[model samples]
Target: MPTGVLYVMSTVVPGLVKIGKTTTGRFDDRMRILERNGYNNVTGLHREFAIEVERYDEKERMLDDIFSKARVPGSELFALDINLAIELLASFEGRQIYPKTSTESKSKVFDDAAKNHQENTDIQCIPEGTYYLDRKRPPLHVEMVVEDGALTIRAGQRVAEHDSDRADDRARELRRATVAADGTVRANVHFSAPSQAAAFIFHLSSSAPNLMALQKVVA
Candidate 1:
């Protein structure tokens, strides 16, 4: 008689979920690698520790099928066999962890200001390519090649998504590019309507130096 087990896990980070099954009880050894790598929030929320899994020759494949259906975008299994492969997949996706509270607090104001400024002007990192607007939407994504001194613009599904939608959807009247005085390849984006151009201009002027420091860390 073959025996097997099933488990459902939720990691320390949000948006991670997984389902897996194993034939043996030694899944912990496989899971330890995750803990070693700082995934301290991993928890097994549900499991069927032992079941007659060997009755079917396709048990491994069956587990894989279950995992494919139940596993979330950022999750994987931990046991050997089907479970190990699943866990490997989750590790590859990379879980998203929250920053510390103090770090969160520090960036909140900058995020707010960015949102406010983005509402009025679309300050974007325009790459070194000519682009035209399509009736569907404006291009919001760019591919940067610093070595080549080129920035290629392309259509994106969302632009300034962190900001609220405006009543008038039209081309932005004011856009400013923030390049470093050191001439490094870096850019910051801000956008506004014609009515808000003056405020956007003033904000960029006052914050350019600080923004440079902020960009340094992000870059």
Candidate 2:
């Protein structure tokens, strides 16, 4: 019958996160303690997402069980993709406690930019060439080619599609991701911008990191 808050924190290490729970009143205090003292000797800890929920203890345990394989023994740390963690946390029925207004609005701006890119196909934000889109956690390396004002997935490894009930459709898209003679997976799907391309490849939202921002130009 315990009600509290569940939170996910990002660590200095990429793709690593800490999932924990605390009473509603102690939420801010807990964050300060973790950020100030650090956890397991790991510093640069920052809150990524949090939610106030009923029976938060049970919710936290459920998440731990779900990600047990990725968890560090005897520790709250898990070697999992931050975005995946965020999605799961957000799905829980509760009021979002972190990423207050300013951050949320920023995310909205990024989404709007993606939408505008889709609607205005003629506006090319990146130059035509080959580039690499690399993500650390749930590690991915995708070779992309931008030509004729279109972005195509030339090759990738460990590509994850958006999770949904449309298994058949997802399978069809995966089928398009063919394996090359060199053993790399290749896809012919075209997108307008890096964000859109990443969203499609990872089944992530518009908030996915834009390759342009990363400056990962290879060609």
What is candidate 1's lDDT per residue for 1-219, written digit by digit as tens?
654443434444433444444444465654444345533346533321222234323544444442343343444533222222222222111121112234443233333434443443232322222322111233223222211332222222122322212312221222213323222213333222111221222223321212211001112
Instruction: Estimate, for each residue in 107-191, the C-alpha lDDT of model 2 and write its tens digit.
Output: 4434454554455443143445566556666676666676787877754554554353423343335534554444355646676
State TM-scores per candidate. 0.23, 0.50
* Runs off by more than 4 Å, candidate 1: 23-25, 38-52, 55-60, 63-219
Whole-model lDDT values for every prediction = 0.30, 0.64
State the weakest 10-residue window (summed lDDT) of model 1: 209-218
Clash number by candidate, in order = 16, 1
- The top-ranked prediction according to TM-score is 2
Stretches off by above 4 angstroms in model 2 are 102-219
